[model samples]
Target: MMKNECSVVQDVLPLYLENMVSEGTTVFVKEHLENCSDCAAEFERLKSGRQIDEAAPQREHDTDVITAVKKKIAKKIFKIVAVVCLVFAVLFCAVLFYTGISYPVTKESISLSTKTDSEYTYIILETKAGKSLFFESKTEDILNDHNEVCGRRIVLYNVQYHNSFTKNTSSMSWGKPLNDEKPYLEVIVELENDTLQISNAE
Candidate 1:
């Protein structure tokens, strides 16, 4: 009879520890535990085990909180890195745009001269120190009222650019073979705000 009672009490111990048993069942289990040493010891062990079981969910909750914090920190770091890279990319493109475009040079910034030999006439062009020049020349047909070509016009211009990588130079010269048959009727220098007529046949 005592052994059977012990089995019944032990089976009910879990429910009793969790306070799920009815009032009558609670009274019976307490009475048995007080009288029986073995059942009392079993109840103590179950109580300790129940405490740990209840604490497990709290520990799991703490771990989840830690993981969530780590993920947020990682996302913030990624955003900072992406923003830094975008800034550098914009600066690089700005530098390229500044260096790539060309503009007509002001007349006050350059000196133009001419040197002649038997075969050719050299147009000597010079820029200020630390600047570079881009020279261009073209010829246009001079027309009369009837639209007939009377002569040719020679146009000359210079554009300038400066950067750290460009060679530091002050002067450049170009020579052209003179055509005796169609002697240059006029030579015009195109400046930023004005035109210079260097030579005119008329």
Candidate 2:
């Protein structure tokens, strides 16, 4: 009878190896395999076969995880490169705008002229390059006050260059009488030496 039981256990060993046996059957098979060498060897053979099937899917799962991680790293790298390129493009455009809109001019290359309109007096500056800048003053007294720079030079605050529908234009108004809200170029002038100095305000 025990030999017949060993044969029955061997027939169901494959299901036990695959973990498809009921709990009671699993307990019975484990007890029989422990006592009988023949059934134990048969169980080892079936277990080895099932392990091959199990290992293949595990390897496939590992491969999928690796592929997913690689894709995530690739997406992050692409985003970083795109952001760096965008920043570089913006800085390049700003440099181009600065070069196109603003240039250096000395007092020798510029002449000042005054014109009277319906509301105010316009102080017009003509450059040797035929570029012009204008400033408005309510009275000649305001203009005289701004022009008084140690009796030797005139200091113009916030001299701005414009490059839009009208090209090669600049402007500055007297600060005390009326203030003009516009961007300014970073250039300082010394009338005594007739020099123009360029600087970065930032």
Candidate 3:
């Protein structure tokens, strides 16, 4: 090789000693080193001279290329595993929702609950067949008793449902003090088939 070729080869020699050249370049270096004892002895000198870490090469990270290749493989494998797990989770959720069963993230409650004697509430359930599914009950209207509590309209149906068959203010227990003694109408619901229920009405 020419002096410039030898110099380029010498510049990459530290990397060669640590097995860090690209395969094509390594082959080129091997061909040159076999014919040139000067380069070969330089190679041997560098190998025996110092610990690999202490010998800072012209470049940093003697094995950066190989380490980067390994990292790419590991990252590809992790992405595949993550996509597979996400697919399984989505399938599981879809199955649960279609079959009306609870999956990992499915809420166990369809019923919302709160307490107060301040407002009246009601829900009108209509079927896909366009039929009203509930009976309107003859309950005493409780909206007449709504009063400002602490300077706000104390909404009750958020606590009480309006279609209650009867209204009782005293029978209601809120685990807290209510301003009213009459049983407030709050309905707890449980569902069966296409039919729905209103429970705990007082």
Candidate 4:
């Protein structure tokens, strides 16, 4: 083969080394390498015995490619997780802020009134403004003082002006009114200097 032809055969040496060429191409390259001294030396250099085994270099190359792909996949997963966590954190803070601003427990946020039916007392809360705040499940027993253990108790916290519910003062327990066909019970809901005093407006 001419010197130029020898160069072309050298270019295909890697595929021949991996046994990846057709039988005819392999025979042609083999004949050129046998006659070409420079190509023979280059092939011998590629076969230098530094591998752990006869085929370890191929395995090592595949391992390197797999490792690179794994690193890229892990980086993408980390970015996705970070973005999702950031979005959830922002949403949580927004809901907390809205609840703190919209549902503040202030003297004006609550009002006490006797329903026209006179059989029930209403704990009017701004949270239930213009909505039916009563449920059949919330029977008179919910307001019965005699059924204290089974009945409901309202635990209120002393909140500072412009403060969040999370920063409210220690809680205090109060027994709810017993609506026993009479609204004569004295209703007192004291919060520091602000007391909510309501009576049966006779």
* lDDT string, candidate 4, 1-202, tens digits: 3988887888888788889999999999899888889899988877674343677878989999999999999999999999999999999998777554523345664555543343444443232232212111112223457644343323234433332435323321222345544334334444545766544442
Q: Please, what is the TM-score per model?
A: 0.48, 0.40, 0.25, 0.39
* Tens digits of lDDT, candidate 3, 80-179: 9999999999998876664443222111323334443445333322222211123223333334345422211112221211222223222222232344
Q: List model 2 lDDT by residue over 1-202, tens digit each.
A: 9999998998888788778899999999999988999889887887788788889999999999999999999999999999999999998898678545744445665555444445443444454433443322221121234453211123443333333333444444211111222212223344434645432212
- Candidates sorted on TM-score, descending: 1, 2, 4, 3
Assess candidate 2 and give its lDDT.
Answer: 0.58
**How much is 128 displaced in model 4, in angstroms?**
5.9
Give me the runs in candidate 1 sitting further than 4 Å from their true place. Answer: 102-160, 164-202
Candidates by lDDT, descending order: 1, 2, 4, 3
Please tell me which predicted candidate would have the highest TM-score against the true structure. Answer: 1
**Stretch of 10 with least lDDT, candidate 2:** 174-183
Best by lDDT: 1
Global local distance difference test of model 3: 0.51
Q: Identify the runs in model 3 with alpha carbons over 4 angstroms from their true place.
A: 51-202
Whole-model lDDT values for every prediction:
0.76, 0.58, 0.51, 0.57
What is candidate 1's lDDT per residue for 86-192, written digit by digit as tens?
A: 99999999878766666667777776677777876666667765555666889888776888776666777664555434455577555555665444355566877
